[model samples]
Target chain A: MRSLKKKERDKLIGDFRSGSVAALARLLSLCESESRSRRDLMSSIYPVENQPFVLGITGPAGAGKSSLINRLLFVFRKRFERIAVLAFDPTSKLTGGAFLGDRVRMAEHIKDEGVYIRSMADQGRAGGVGAGIHDTIGLLSAFGFEMVIVETVGTGQSESDVRLIADLVLVVLTPGFGDEIQAMKAGILELGDLFAVNKADQPDAERTETEIKASLALGRSQTAEAPPVFATVATQGRGVVELAGCLLEKYQELGREGVIDARRSKRVEAHVEEMLKEHCAMLVASEIKAFRTKRAKAAGRINPYRLAGALISKIFKAENNAKKD
Target chain B: MGKIRVVVAKLGLDGHDRGARVISRFLRDAGMEVIYTGIRQSPEDVCRVALHEDADLIGVSILSGAHNALVPRLIAELERSALDIPVVVGGIVPDDDIDFLRSKGVRAVFTPGTPVEEIVKTVNAIVEEKRAG
Candidate 1:
């Protein structure tokens, strides 16, 4: 993608601010690619005061996350004037491609002018959400969406990055996920602010819910409140209204107690730390690549450990010299 | 550069979506992000999806012979939204309607026997032109 010129960038931002979905979509594409323009766009949009309430939906594959979000949109749309969903699907590690089929479930809202849905490829990010998710959320919030719902790619036990970015995380599960032992496992069970046992029409639904509650009871002490688990049939839209209402109530409760502000501060801190690490990793990778190319014609085999140590010292020395200058 | 994003939609009451699915898979394997909008989407729904996705192209697969009616409506909807994204038609589109569809602002059309590689090449070329232009 070509870098946006200053005039073009300004016009795109202006159009985005004025509620042009086309401009917003183009900006999101820019965020997904083109790191330099992404930095410019984020710097321009980060100062916006409107921070959309971010709700993250995560669960294992075939857990009805997308279907649940489809039902949740109906309820969320009634309350928020404008809503956006960032649906993530994994990119193929081999082909660098992705099949984003989440919108098929949320097709009912396609014609609703107030709802914006964008499908994202995770771009080889091992975490549940995509690499571009934070920037995408910022763009949507700056575009004035009152709520932004992020749906992670089908996740496993350790993919809990959603907890960092989401103000409220809802972990969707299905019947026969496991007994209390499964719930007692660390990682995913601990991340949910709320839980939904979707596909509740199945026979084991009540059992799974009970096991989760039992595990939570055993895990937490007397004072800590356990996250509520609701039995839902997302395909049939059963028990979803109550779930949606509970989510909204929980969001408000968090806001009233100043937890939202605290979480946002933590999120910002983590985001900056991540950006710094990524920037330094890029520099190190380029340095290593250059080193390898320059050493390609050397006669002797290079010791990997020694090369790494020398590179680290060289980077540190360069940093110190730049700081001194 | 970012991966080209394409919205492959089945417009109208057409229940036959095998072609759409196959094309979507082909595009996916070719390194594009293919957003499959499933079957039974209206022209407006397709347009809205294209707009929200910021798609480089819209590929409409119509097998129910509703191409003449639905394709024009889709183009009109795109014009209504002022989105310059290109559109391509595939699946059961008669040879006679190919020119008609193209004149209606479709970037390209493919019939049943069109090679998958040809389809991929056409889609890439259209998106490349769109990005360059």
Candidate 2:
């Protein structure tokens, strides 16, 4: 991984600003890491304009989120020319690497110049989505994609973080996976602005739909329109266009209600907090490593909490001195 | 602490992806994002994916004895695209052809029985050097 030199970085930024697909891909790779280069790249493109509407697609591994997203892409492409898909598959807990196979499911748009698809390995960050996902979304939005769809490996509760980034989140579920009530127990069901009962062609489709509707009826507010539930056979492209239309309508309604602004604000807030938390953790780990190397004699005697407090103080003191300087 | 993005591919008509999958797991364990391009990927397909993914390095696991034909074409494609990604070859390379593969711009080569840790270390060192320079 070569670090982008100043000249190259500048040129890449220039191309990226001018809408070069190659440059955007490189910039995305830069944002994927936690490095000085990532900082440089972010600062170079901060305060994004023409922000794309972000839609989150999340479900269990077997829930067909990829196929659902593929269908949505087709429907969305009819209205929005520039669309970017960020698919995150879980990283192996035993090994940090992942084999992201969303491309196989999304083979339809491989040749479309308007569509940009990228897969990210969820490297066990705080949430189901990778730590860099927010930044990646910003990059895609900044790169002028009209819609940026994020498909996460929504295994369970932790994936609820999808709400923090997407203005609208679709939770897809298939029939016969389990009792619909059991599936909804994880609070993941509540996070969705829309519910998709995919594989509607299957034998249990109607039962699944009824179960979801019953669950929603029990939980949702009676005052507002319940989040529309769509029966979708994603592979067959059934009910996709209607779902897409409903999504667009909901997006417009949200925009009219000033909800998009609030959601975007929440997204930014979460991104800042995550970055700060990671930075502080990295700083503490480095300080502890240095302390361990330098104070060999005091290793056993020193209290862990005291050392942590001392390191935190030192970091703040250094920051204050730098501010004064 | 950024993720190292790697493209693990099997080029030509090779149907056996066990070695590629194993190496992918090894690299992933080593904290790199391994994008396995499945099996029977063309040189053009490999290079396109490598570039599109902004891969830091590409690992080609060849077992069909097509290394002599495929690896160079992959390198050529990368050169043509102006992508400066390093290439590593694994599996079933004749001992005599190691230097030839190296001469064709393969940064590293691993044969059967090479420890996975060694491959990881070599890749890390090369990546670190590239980043530092």
For lDDT, the strongest prediction is 1
Question: Which stretches of model 1 miss by more than 4 angstroms?
Answer: A296-325
User: Which digits, one per residue and each the tens of the lDDT, describe model 1 over residues A1-325?
Assistant: 5677889889998998898889999999888774766787678887768988999999888999999999999999999999999999999999998999999999888878888999999998887878867778888888898999999998658558888888999999899988777778847788889999999999989999999888767757789899999999999999999999999999999999999889888888887887888778977988979987898776378788888899989988987998799
Clashes of each: 0, 1
Compared with the true structure, what per-residue lDDT tens digits does model 2 show for residues B1-133? 3567888888999889989988887887787887777677889878877766778789999999989899999999899988888999999999888999999999999999999899999998877776665
DockQ of each: 0.84, 0.37
Residue-wise lDDT of candidate 1 within B1-133, one digit each (tens)?
5899999999999888888888899999999999999889999889889988989999999889989999999999999889898999998887899999889999899998999999999999998887888
Off by over 4 Å in 2: A1-9, A20-22, A35-37, A275-317, B12-16, B61-71, B90-104, B107-129
- lDDT for model 2: 0.84
Any residue pairs clashing in model 1, and if so which? none
